[model samples]
Target: MNGGDVTEEAGEPVPESLWLATTSSTEYEPLPGDRRVDTAIVGGGIVGLTAAIRLKEAGHEVAVIETGRVVEGVTGHTTAKLTSQHGLRYDRLCSTFGREYARQYATANEAAIDAVERRVEEDGIECDFRRTEAYVYTESRSDGSDLLDETRAARRLGLPASYTETTPLPFDVEGAIRFDEQAEFHPRKYLLALAAAVDGDGSSVFETTRALDIDPGRQPRVTTDRGVVVADQVIVASHFPFFDRGGYFARVHPKRAYLLAVRISGEPPEGMFYSTATPPATIRGAPVDGERLLIVGGQGHEPGLDGPATSERYRRCEAFARERFEVESVEYRWSTHDLSPVDGVPFVGRLGPTTRNVYVGTGFDGWGMTGGIAAGTILADLIVNGSSPWADVFDPNRFTPAASAKALVEDNALVAARFLGDRIRTALAGSGTLPSPGEGTVVRQGGKPVAVSRGEDGELHAVSAVCPHMWCLVEWNDAERTWDCPCHGSRFDPDGTVRSGPALEDLTDRSG
Candidate 1:
């Protein structure tokens, strides 16, 4: 669902990302009955769109089926930083995998940035792309050594990295690593331009078309709500793969983070700054309606974490922004979900070991802008040439058991605990009470958990709380007014329609 369509119980508009609010919406018709294409892309975010463009350019017929509007998914909700400076990544990558693999990761991301810039220039896409330095700094004395080590690791790999004592942030810092020639842009605008380019030459982009299943065969078929897209290859770029035959749920952990765009009283930051401190903060500037606003983000936690409510996350971000910068007004606030792989590297190749034709790209770990583009390029090459030089690094089927074993166990354990714990708690709690307007809760009804939410109009809406993806109890996201799965990050509208997936089906309505 679009941000403009979501509202709170008081009938006040829920805060939207500055990107979504500022950009004009574009509409595309859903897939008309059954269709056939050489490739079927299941998502319309940056990854899917870029893959569509690349595949179509390679002379393959492509179709993009999006459950919602193109580019309005996680891509539209991102900080839109096109840098490879994911927090403390290089050091870990070097230690875990090796220096060469880390270098390849860095190279892939650097190439992704260049690819985006090259496309914008060649296509004349007016997406307000701008080049700026990226900084990862720390205020803590303990993190200083980490920052320096990261700089060393990055620079040794030929990345444009240097350790510095200063940053564009208004506050002081102990140390920071600066990566030059990084960039940022309006992601929706760029994707829209690409979507337009993909809408011809026997290729098409479809909105509001949900992919239900993928049938593996010599020629894969993607089953959807309206029809099936029979294609020689399928790419599951839908943030979380809809068809989880490869058991991606066990490999990826989803974290939710908040963002706030505020008008600062003084000059905005000149560069992108990300802090390595606790409760990490990322600061960047966005030109909006002739004035540059400071976008402050980062207060991440797994969904359904017991401590703070969803609104509290935004409030924390707002507080950080106002305290650090002389904020004038908070223009926008939003949250985005990121999928982090057990290992630092993203999974961007064939969906499974034997499933050569079906591909997937995920586990961006909050660096989707670059990761997604890199995935697009890699997937495009794999689909066309049947191989990519980067395939060994990003192979979705490759198992680094020693490195990822602990994470895989821990993440799945948390999921199992949440799943069983929520069910028991709700069973003991029992249902019957109706929450007030703008409130939601899970309670037992006839020995089953029911999700009950009251809207602004005082209408009670109820649905089964179990997520169709993996039977994890869906938690109420008051900020977004949706049921969010804690296990795999599937989200559904209050009325139970699927908003994001891995869960292709709607929550069963049990209000009656």
Candidate 2:
């Protein structure tokens, strides 16, 4: 599609989240030369900032290193449902890892909600924080049994779960797993406050400072673009651990999803709604100018696996919204990717086996809203008190063959296939036409793969197609106007700068 076509379809020149556009951003400079702190947290998203705040409460000096603005990473682009009901998770967790694991998972997330509430109340943070019921509903009768099972599992795990056929939705649902006293919030507003709290008082928040590597030892050193941050401990919370010593790239798979904020003709549903359908749809209302605007999200797929179809996810979400609600206009559109663990749980705590003073949190499985905050307390407990009740539950070193073996094997196999298979097709697809405005593609240049694109203004740009993270061929994400590495979900701007996802470094500039 051309630039005009993309604008007409996606409602903007580039996809922007509703939270980002509505909030004011920070002006913190990059790491000013070498720094020293008690703890240096990498990545300025929810997990890093939350952990930084908790450590500060324990009187620890901290510094945060961010590739971009704080809270503008995965934490800024979430569905923002703060609940223990993680999309029918307990049933699968119980079946896979047993009730004990499920209970701890439930407890951490439930307490995550309370943690956010307590912080908001204590700090007087006006982040549009409000309690709402969270639902995982199914529209198909055939899915009711599974939904009922999930409800039973959640309730048994002490989540306030209720099974219901009727809902406050505009359309009908066969059944749903409902949890009471859950919440929806302006995540950026809340975390921005935490970021502010994390700054000053011998603590620091550094933006535009990307952590390139971590040297974990007596004093863990986080090497960054500007300088190094030497600290007593370190936390890698950059969504997809930029430094993957734990082989997280294998245990966790990448899934890309789209989101759109639209104004409806009438009132939206008064709670968070997630459907249990394939590629599961999510609906939640946000306050907009004294009224409410419905945010429709879904149409998920593995990165690079879908090829040219990646751009069509936004259209799919638009169609879903129009078919159900009276979408007056799609006000905002954005896309975000999450790391899904092969197992049901997230990997938190130590960065790897036999590692000390280095912690990592990733594989949130698209529930970073709660998981990120929970990870903060978990990491804080591990750092200050040496252990937490959730230590073993989310231990990065803890591996269960039954829970993770199949997925771990499948994920790596797909990666290996892509690494080989993409190259196999590259030579044939090279010499194709230069991408139209707002589009990009990988082509053969001098017998090597080159990622090339044209801007909205018709200016051409090029970069080496190989991803710095794992050497997987990069693919064009037309909707987001970025090059996405299918293997690790590392995204880069048209100019080759790392936009988000893994890959701590940018794509190689291929200027002639």
Which candidate wins on lDDT? 1
**lDDT values for all models:** 0.87, 0.86
Candidate 1, residue 225: the lDDT equals 92
lDDT of 2 at 2: 10
RMSD of each: 3.8, 2.8
**TM-score between candidate 1 and the true structure:** 0.96
Clashing pairs in 1: none
Model 1, 1-512: lDDT tens per residue?
Answer: 00121121222223898889988888899999999999999999999999999999999999999988998889999999999888888888888878777888899999989998999999999887999999998878888888888999999888999999988788888999999999999999999999999998799999989998889889999999989999999999999888887889889989888988877787798999888766678889999888898888788878765757887667677667666777777778889898989887899998987776799999999999999999999999988898877777788887777678888888888877887888777978757577889888998888788999999999999999999888989998888888899888989999999888888889999978
- C-alpha TM-scores of all predictions: 0.96, 0.96
Residue-pair clashes, model 2: 0
Q: Please give the distance, in angstroms, between residue 372's alpha carbon in candidate 2 and its true position after superposition.
A: 0.4
lDDT of 2 at 173: 77
Model 1 ranges off by over 4 Å: 1-14
The per-residue C-alpha lDDT of model 2 at residue 358 equals: 92
